[model samples]
Target: MDPCTYKRYHKHDQDSRQYLDHYFSDKSQMVFGEDALIFPIKSLTNAFAAGHIKGDILLDISHGSLVHHLYSACEFFKHMIVLKIKDRCILELKRWTDKRTGAFHWGHAAKHHADIEGKSHQLEDKEVKVRSAMQHVVKCDLEKENMTKPIVLPPADCIISTLLLEAISKDQDDYIRYLRKFSRLLKPGGHFMLLGCLGETYYTVGRDKFHAFSYSDDFVRKALEGEGFIIDHCKLQKRTAVSDLTDYKAVIFIAAHNKK
Candidate 1:
C-alpha cells in the first residue's frame, strides 16, 4: 500500500470508542495490557517516585482517550492540561472525568496501578485524584504554527506524550518538527517523558489501518538531542504479544530534560 494512501491520524476521523475497546478494554490480554498499558504505567510511576519528573503543570499530548498512564502522574503534578487533536477524543475523556453514565470503565487499569504501588485498597481514591488533577482538556491542531493557537498555555514543568507523534507524523522530518513543537511547551530544565513504539508500522483502529512512523532507538535519541534535550534515561522492552492489530518490535520509554 502506498504510504500516501495510509490514513493520517489528524486529517481523518477516528473512532474514539473503538480505539478504547481494542487496546484499553479492561479484559484486553497481555498484548495491550502488558506492553501498551502496564509498561508505561510502571515507567511513569518509577519516574515520579524517584523524583525524576514532577512539577506544578504537566502537559499531556497523548493518543486516544486513554487515561491509564495518568494514574501515576497525578500524584506528582498539581495540574494537568491535555491537548487533543480530535473532538471525539476530548468528549470521550470528558465523559469519564464528569462521571457520566456510559463512560468507559478503566477500573482494571487502575487496579493494576494500585497493585504495583501496593495500595490496592486505594483504587477509588486513585481515580478521583486523576480526575481532580486533570484540569483542562483542550483541542489542538499540530499542523498550525502554534498548536494551541489563541489559547496560549503556560510553560509546563513536565510534558508526557505517549504514542502520539508516531501516529501523526508522516515521516522523520515531521516527527522532528513535532518534537520541536513539544519542546517549546516546556520550561527550560523541565522534564519530557515519551512512551512510544519502536519499529513496525500500521495500527488498525476499528476497520481502518492508520500510518505509524517507524524509527529506531538511535533515531529517537538523535531527534531529542537535536531539539536541545538532554537524555536522562531510556528503557526498551521487547514485544511479547503476538497479534495483527499492530506490529511493533518494541516499546520504548525515554526521560529527558530540556537544556537551558
Candidate 2:
C-alpha cells in the first residue's frame, strides 16, 4: 500500500476522516484532571473489553495522560496492573480516584493493591504543605544498570505498550535488545498490541524528545524472530495523525507475541 495522508482520530471514524467528536461532548469535559485526555486510551481499552484480549497483567508506559485506560481494565481483564512513571500521569490518576470513593489506588504499581486492602498512594487537591514535604523526601539510589544480560521474556497472558519502544535503544541491535526486553515481560504464549507512529518525525514534551522509528514488518519480523517472538499479524491503520492535508501515510505496526 502506498503512503497517504490522514486525519488524527481515524479510529473514531471507520472512513478514517470523520473524527468521532466525543462519546459525550458536554460530559467529555472531566471536572478534576481536565488537563489530561483519557479518550483515546478509553477507546482502545473499550475495544479490548468488547473482545477476548484480556491479560493477567497490563502495563502501558506510553506516558499518555489518558486516564480512561485504567477504567477499561475494570471491564476487560481479570487482573489489571498500571504504572505512572511521571508526575503528570499521577495527577491524571489522582483526579479520578478522589477520596470520595473512600479508596486509595496507587501502590507499588500493581493490581494487588486492589485485592488486599492497604495504605497506598493517595490523591491530593492542592495540598501545598504536602507537596512541599514531598520535596524533601529522598529517593533510593538507582539500581546498577546491567548490559549484555541474556534477554528473556517473563510469562504473561498479554502485554500492550505504545510510544515506549521508541525511547529504548535506537539502532537495529538496540531495537532487537528491546524486543528481548519485552519478551521477558510477556508470557510464553501471550499476545500484545503496539500502536504507534511508524513514520513520526518528532514530538517533545517538557524536555523529552520522542523520535519516530519506521520499519517494514519484514524488518520487524526479522528482528523479533531472533528474540523468540513471531509475527502473527501486521496492519497499516489510517491513523488520524496527518501533519498536513497531503500526507496520507499514517501509523504502521507489526502486532505479534511469543512463538514458542
Candidate 3:
C-alpha cells in the first residue's frame, strides 16, 4: 500500500478497547492460548527470572495498548518508558495506568505473572507493581530520524517491542529501518526483546484490515545482525488456531543485544 492508503487505513476507526479484548481477554486465549500469547509471556518471565535479561531501565515501543507481556519484567526495571505511534493508543494505555473507568481488564495477565512467580494470591499486588513501574508514556514516529521527538529520553538498558514492526511497516525495508531506529534508543550492549508474528500478512481491528509484513526467523536475525546486534536467544511457537482473524504462521520471541 502507498503512504496515503496506509494513513487512511490507520486513521479509520479502531475501537482500542474492543481490539484489546478480542486479543487479550481471558476468552481470547482459547484462540491464541499457547503459541501466540502464553508462550511469549512465560518466556519473558523466565528470561528475567533466570537473569538472561535484567536492567534498571526498559523502553517498550508497543503497537497497541496491550501490556500482557510486561507483567513479569516490571520488577527487574526501576523505570519503564512506554511509547506508541498514535495518540488514541496512548490514551487507551493512560486510562489503564490512571485507573479510569472502562479500562480493559488486566487481572488475568497479572495473575498469570503471579502464578509464574509462585505468588498467585497477590494478584492485586502484582498489578500495582506493574502499573507503578511504568513511569512515562511518549509518542514515537518511526519515520523520523529520532523515533521520540521533542522529549529526549535516557538511553535504555533494555528495549521491548511487541508485534509492532510488522504491523506498521509496509515491507522489509521499512521493517529494517524501524529496527535501526529502535536500536538508537538503547545504550551499547543493551538488550532488545522483540515479540512478533511470523509470516503474518494481515490483521483486523474493528472491521478494518491492516497490512502486516510477512517475515521469517532468518529475516529477523539478519536485520538484527545488520543493525549490530548479537542474537542471544530466540524461540518460535507455531500457530495452533486456524482462524480468519489473522494469517500468522507462528509467534517469535527473540532476545538480542547491541554489540559491545
The predictions' CA RMSDs to the true structure, in order, are 1.3, 12.3, 2.4
Ranking of all predicted structures according to TM-score, beginning with the best and ending with the worst: 1, 3, 2
- lDDT (10s digit) by residue, model 1, range 170-221: 7899999999988899999999999999996888888888899999999999
Residue 188 in candidate 1, Cα distance off native in Å: 0.6
Residue-pair clashes per prediction, in order, are: 0, 15, 0
TM-score of 1: 0.97
Better of 1 and 2 by TM-score: 1
- Pairs in clash, predicted candidate 1: none
Winner by TM-score: 1
* Candidate 2 worst ten-residue window by lDDT: 15-24
Query: In model 1, which regions exceed 4 Å deviation?
Result: 1-3, 28-30
Candidate that would win on lDDT: 1
In model 3, how large is the Cα lDDT of residue 250? Answer: 90
Stretches of candidate 2 above 4 Å error?
1-52, 67-74, 99-155, 206-210, 244-249
Q: Each candidate's lDDT (Cα)?
A: 0.90, 0.40, 0.82
**Superior by lDDT: candidate 1 or candidate 3:** 1
